[model samples]
Target: MTHATELTVIHVPVSDPRVRPLLQELGDEYSRRYGKDAHGEISRYPDEEFTASHGGVLLLLLEHGEPVAGGAFRRYDATTAELKRIWTHSAHRRRGLARRVVTELEREATARGYRRIHLTTGPRQPEARGLYLATGYTPLFDTEADPETIGPLPFEKHLPATATHRATHRGKAAQP
Candidate 1:
């Protein structure tokens, strides 16, 4: 097992070559679970959507210079960052890597001036559902309903407003 100290986090554009392996494996995993090509979903958003200049970022956790886990978030609204493409390599599962990825994304989003986060995991992805829940995300849908009937399970987390965020909203009416 790799120790946490051995892992390194780096931000890169979604188009980086190192990102390809993660995407390919993630696409294959999604295809197997949903019985359809999910590569389209992977590419649904334009490449620029995950660039830093656009209020978005993609991060990968690498060990020994090889990508082991990764995730990304795009600007959902002025105050919300929408997480997408969170994945841990199949061989690297059960190691708490996804949680690390999520934590890192949240930190990055907060630094980028976002006060909330929105994300959806496919109904077929129970592990993802658990991960978000364990990480303090509230489900936006009824958890008791059958997952298949629910389709994509939406979850959200309101980040602790940074000093910048608090200052920006100091005298303004709180947005609902």
Candidate 2:
């Protein structure tokens, strides 16, 4: 018997067919929330950015072998990873699945020697902002009026040095 508590997350290519519908749903939600222009800017993530060898990853949270939620991250700099596409099925919200995806992605970043994680969520996604803050991420751009960026509130999380090797992507060690 599989309880919802036993949901599994697997890393896959961002373009995997299993995740296509979820992406469409995400697109629809974005258009509904932030209007079309912003949605257009935010759609689509490149595949090479989500493959493992490049220190990028895409994850799908599955139940009974079916995708329920998803997220991804890519090498941002030598020491930083940029998180993206954190989405939960409308039927799956409030289930903690998105949190699990974020936690797993962070672990993957740490495992690969990333020292910090960066991400952004649109103003329409108050829940996402709250999720990040609740999970210890700090907001990066709060008071900038008339921001030039067309999408999302930027957030960052500095990972503790718990791995045998610090991340190589940063080109230099991050100051503690």
Candidate 3:
């Protein structure tokens, strides 16, 4: 009998080598689904936009030290984080990795004082839509309408203030 390997999350820069496969596959999937090269969309933002120094983050789920899933979030506003590139390796789907990635991104964003998260999944991606809804995101577009007509389907979740944010609000130093 085979045992399941443990999964671990790690923060990394978008330029990290392990991140390449996820990006490539994600671009390929997007292109295939949208019937156009997704290179531009995938590269729309500068890599620095997903780094900690820029008030953003990129993280990956590693299984046996190889990336199996990953996602990123960048500062969207004074109190919101914009989630991007949430992907689970094609072979690793239906195992809840995408949800795990979203949860991790939320935790990180909360730690950084973001009060909410905003994201948009492509219209062609019903799985992503289901994931967001099942995970408590409020759909910004009408659910009964045709998704293709809606273009990118937007969602948002208001995060509860973490202890750090509360401490900041209270004018006290937060414990590390």
State, as a TM-score between 0 and 1, how close model 1 is to the true structure: 0.94
Worst 10 residues of 2 by lDDT: 167-176
Candidate 3: residue 79 Cα off by (Å):
0.3
TM-score of 3: 0.93
Candidate 1 lDDT trough over 10 residues, lowest sum: 167-176
Which scores better on TM-score, 1 or 2?
Answer: 1
> Least accurate stretch of 10 residues (summed lDDT) in model 3?
167-176
The list of candidate 1 runs beyond 4 A from truth reads: 172-176
Screening candidate 2 with a backbone cut-off below 3 angstroms (N, C-alpha, C), the clashing residue pairs are 78-169, 78-170, 79-169, 79-170, 113-167
Task: List, residue by residue over 1-176, the lDDT tens digit for candidate 3.
Answer: 11235888999998899999999999999999999999789999999989988889999999989899999998887778999999999988888888899999999988888888999999999999999999999999999999989999999999887865796666543221
- lDDT of candidate model 1 versus the reference: 0.91
How many backbone clashes does every candidate have? Answer: 0, 5, 0
Q: Please name the candidate that would achieve the greatest lDDT relative to the true structure.
A: 1
Instruction: lDDT winner between 2 and 3, please give it.
Output: 3
lDDT of each: 0.91, 0.80, 0.89
Order the candidate numbers by TM-score, best to worst.
1, 3, 2
Candidate 2 per-residue C-alpha lDDT over 1-176 given as tens digits, one digit per residue, 9 for 90 to 100 = 22557798788886689888677888888888765743455455567878988779989989888888989898888889999888898987887888888989999888777889999887768789889988999988763543335456899999877646544434556431
TM-scores for all candidates: the values are: 0.94, 0.84, 0.93
